[model samples]
Target: MPRTILILNGHPDPSGKGLCHALGEAYAEGARTAGHEVRRLDVASLDFDFLRSQAAFESEAPPPTIIAAQADVLWANHLVVIFPLWLGDMPAMLKAFFEQVLRPGFAFSYRPRGFPVMHLKGRSARIIVTMGMPALVYRWYYQAHGLKNLARNVLGFVGFAPVRDTIVGSVATRGRESIGRVLEKVRELGRRAV
Candidate 1:
């Protein structure tokens, strides 16, 4: 059966000639070609307050758009993220989105004894991360993926297992061909995804 795929463009830097956006487009185009319904949410273009103020969290009066975004996440069978690795992590806006949207009752829960509970599962996820540094050096030096552990580990704890990741290393120095190669790989992944 056909599936619904949600794409999140987390790059805060807006560039008409950016390689990251191209990667996202390539993945979306490939997913569409493979007969999956695709929905995209570009964080940079969204007009919502990113700050998690006390009123924003406790007042039950979040912006209408945030409410809508939560709905979209729940409706998808696949989740894909296209973003740059700024300072070894996602943009602050995207991270803030997680803080706001991935609320306790929504994305996860807790056991009676203070154990963890998961609410999102039965859906696959993919993250296409671009970095200015080489993956090996970054991994060795940083001793980490330079990515969000929550998206894969925390979310994976609940039900989003097998969260696939695509790392576009050396973005700051990659050539046109290198970028194309990464895009091609992403496209192939999208095509083969169930």
Candidate 2:
């Protein structure tokens, strides 16, 4: 079956040729070749302010950029987020983008008695992270805390089920052949719509 795939190029750098950008393009290419609809958002090019207060977070209207982004989120069945791990976590702009788009009432709503009501229950996500460290070190020694936080605390909290991830490590040092293999692997994932 065909799926609607939203590829978020989350690198803070605006360059279109970075590893994250290449990976996102690869995913979109494979998805399109397989007849899946694909849309992409380059986070670095978007303009939006950070949520600084509880009032702003709870009640403020989102910027136009965010409103469109939310619409994209709503339109897609599968989301592919590609970013470079910075200081062990996602770039601040990408995090802020999430804060803007996944606002209250859009992503979830609080319940008086217990857990918040999730609005995105039928969606799924794939997070791809590029980092300077070895993948095993980030997953094992570091416990992949940042990745887990985004996957479980944020995406899962909002109702995206079976959130998955691809961690590409030693990115800066990877040879062209290795990078090509990684890109091919990501493309296959896109082809499968998983």
lDDT of 2: 0.93
Q: Candidate 1 on 1-194: residue-level lDDT in tens?
A: 67888888888765534877787788888888998888888777766776657556544555677778888889998888777877777778887776677766777776778757778878888877878788776667886554547455545765786787777788878778887788888888777763
The lDDT, on a scale of 0 to 1, for candidate 1 is 0.75
TM-score per candidate: 0.88, 0.98
Model 2: per-residue Cα lDDT over 54-113, one tens digit each: 999889999999999999999999999988888889999999999998888999998889
Q: Show the colliding residue pairs in model 1.
A: none
* lDDT scores of the candidates, listed in order: 0.75, 0.93
